[model samples]
Target: MSAHTTASGSTWAPSSRKPPLRARLLRASWRGLPAKRHDIGWEPGLVVPAADGSPLVTDHYFPRAEGDFPTLLVRSPYGRGLPWSPMYGVLFAEQGFHVVLQSCRGTGGSGGTFHLWRNESSDAQATVAWLREQPWFDGKLGTVGPSYLGYVQWALAREAPPELKAMAVQVGLHDPYALFYEDGALRLDNSLAVGAGMTYQHQGTGPFLRAMLRLRRRVRTAVGTRPLRDGYAPALGGGIPWLDEVLAHPDARDAYWQGADPGEAAARRTVPTSLVTGWHDALVDQAFVQYARLRAAGCETALLVGPWDHTSALQQGWPEVFTESLAWLRAHLCADPSGLRPTDVRIHVGGGQGTWRDLDAWPGQPAVTSWFPASGGYLTRQPPTDSAPLASFRYDPADPTPSVGGPLLSGAAGSRDNTALEAREDVLTFTGPPLSEPVEVVGPVSAHLRVHADTGYADVFTRLCDVDPQGRSVNVCDGLGRLRPQDGRTARLTVPMSATAHRFAAGHRIRWQISGGAHPRYAPHPGTDAARVDATEFTPVRLTLHADSALLLPQGAEDGQEVTAAP
Candidate 1:
């Protein structure tokens, strides 16, 4: 485990078969140099028996020519054809690595029951053992995938498989609590969408499911209804019961979450990992938390953050992201880091700093700057001395503020034009004057608000926005905090907004939009101590924000002098 065998030492078997037509063309293009791309062929339905005696199905892809090669494995439930294998499995095989794309238990062509994370660890261990028995496997192996695919890598790494040399994980959500729920509020839209997709895939894409998916408006309407647990019964056809199980457990404290969470297995990890994520991705925050935990356990890790959402991280113009992954694999699996970008932290800064920055470490201890709310809808660096500077808004559960883009999987995800959202009377906005010079805020942001609600319970949502000279307000980061019954006393809510590295230009202003809820992204609070999403009782609650409330921003150096872009 101390060191991997060199690339030359590992490939002991010399290839005697002729290269495929595509490999020949690539060789011709390289003019006798090592070809980087080649044609690949796969053997379908390789039955690998799991520890439970269930057969796990996989498609193994390799270069057309016969030879010993390092293996790259991917275990996913999204099927093994088209997008999953054709896009990644074939790509790696063409690069001289044998790729194994397996469908999870009870999914695609695999066997056994399908319950998330229950069978992955054992199945993965058995599969790795099976690969070593194959004649074509060289001694090196690695894993790669994104989202759930990424989660599988982490799950298997927890088992500490000896052949598991390295991993390339992108947007992986190992914590089920955070994945399904946030701040004790259910992520309505995301939970429903994932369940619908799984049901469609698992139960066969029948006419009913296909028709329901096409009519998205009906889906949104159903999500808005009370008794959220049973709302999806019609669309899902009574299948994929996991959604209700998640809603039943309000937070991470429950034991149900332990099965899916990486748990103590993370400390056992010896595999070097490369993590890729986007600033706007729903799981970006969790991705960073996982990296920190792995690094604390003395594992080698690197991070790459882009300006993409969950979908764009894989589908959009993000080739450089995967290129970084390839380099990481080559370094650890093949012991060759040539032509590879150095292993370091890379981040994409938004808000007019349209470039990437490489750092020796994460932006060190951001200079915390505190900005307070002033009268007449304004934000100021100076605290309000006025004894009773207070603002009030009426929040009716029937008319909750709608979601407008930020860390969501729905179509309306990522930053969007928030001009209309900011204009709502129910949403309190405190704006600062145009900055005299540009300022960079590059770390976690939090807001401290002393709030009082007429009702026993309420939900507080805070957003950070950049107001351009043309009056367009775009969301940067936002978070939600639920307040319990104060019993006639004011409650102090410290809402920790998402982290970001954005710059406000000289002519732009900073704004904070405070509301009671962000529906669909988060279920609307029912104005009671019971945080259940099924309650439909609408109570109009008057909420007050004390002038002492302030936004804490982690600012960079004075002026933008210290902020530099990587070449």
Candidate 2:
């Protein structure tokens, strides 16, 4: 293990072994990383432009051995100093290629101030260019990551640099506005955390930090007296619509969003790519659409959807996920023994069914069965003969439903059903009868519903769960919809259900939950002034489930594709 520091300008030799920059960067990183039999580590490179025309920081850990290793470049807004890169970094590197992690222009030891994703594209492009110039680099490159880290890949891809051979983006911020706001409404929780966290991370983090602190205190005071039912947004009381600041633009073609379309031009090039997502992932649609678009454009792109939530990609069950991803990368950037052109797609079987299957493509030729909503908290095969007394719940923006783990949280903590989160009243639950035959639902999941709100604008959150005989509602997948729904055409939109391939056993039940909001999972849509009432006012919304509403199944798709089985 060798260590080299470019700090204030100094490069070192480790134990008399002189390695090239690429090997040095990765080896340095690997040496310091926590080691595990299943884990891999290495040093690579980071290219940062210095203010005084010197060097910024240029040592990284690309994931493969030196000598023409295909590269996977990751440029993160977070500190590369953090363990996240080393943890996921080395694994990808050892997957038969080079993996590189670099601190963004301003974060960590890299020189510069972080302006969110604004200036990241150039740094990423430069880093890729630098990587291509290395003796150990093979010139083939791809990018992968989630959230802010994922956002960087997309930002750089818009430029479509020559060396960005391909990418595998998860839960990325395609449209900052869509991610942050809902029709001018801000996601108070995300706003608080993001603004607060960044402020704390910055030097003096300045006014943003001070203001968020004060607002937090006010919010606590507001929610303190109200029953947990009054809701929690205004209670936090802060200024500047962080959501408004970012999500003001919802159109996909908007210059701001289109300029940095993470999907980039992978389709136009012969870039072989793969997309990773969870059934309950909020960004499922973004990645799904991108994967579809890339594939349609003749790029050798594959899609892999699982039942795990946001962070589950790193759990004990992630081996299969990584396996397929490695195979995909290996086929494209490394080596492939199978004459197969990297089996087109892969998905885990749904309904507690474990195993992976391959297919010619997504939404495969599958027999789609519809499960309609019944009157008495039941989701049945037959549409209700009588419109059961419409169940109603008070959706107070202040105390909306809290997220208890799911893809919507991007695998954030509350995603799984390990704890008893279903006990809350705000969460409306619907369960299906035990299965008579094993049913495997694969591919993307979607919720089709006719929604109505007393207010002009609204937010719809949905979750699909696997209920064991023990009555344990283990969340399987979830999706969110922010609606103004002013146009009748837009209200009937088909959103990608969190992608999953699960098999329901002979007796397990399927559950679907609909609620107004999921904190942190998404921001709340605080009813406008047009709606009356305040502390006592709760917006009552009635959502109608139509018999025609059905989950599309890619029937006949067997999980034998060149993909990995999900946990």
State which candidate has the highest TM-score. 1
Q: Any idea what lDDT model 2 has?
A: 0.56
Clashing pairs in 1: 227-534
Task: Give the lDDT of residue 45 in candidate 2.
Answer: 46
Supply every candidate's count of residue pairs whose N, Cα or C atoms clash at under 3 angstroms: 1, 60
Model 2 TM-score (2 dp) = 0.72
lDDT of 2 by residue, 1-567 (tens): 554332223333323223344433644543322233222444434455633222335445543122345677766655454334434465665555556776666555667655655666677766766665555555677777666666777667667777666666655555555444433434444444555444334233344456456656665443333332233345333332433334444355557554545444534554566677655555565677677677678877777666555556545335545555565666666566352334666566655436666667886656666666666678877755653334555576766667676544322543366335656665667788887876766655677665545554567777777787888777666667766646442255454455566776778888877777776445445554331112244455544444444444333454455335232
State the displacement of the C-alpha of residue 219, model 1, in Å, after optimal TM-score superposition.
1.8
| Model 1 lDDT on a 0 to 1 scale | 0.76
Q: How many clashes would you count in candidate 1?
A: 1
**Model 1: lowest-lDDT 10 consecutive positions:** 26-35
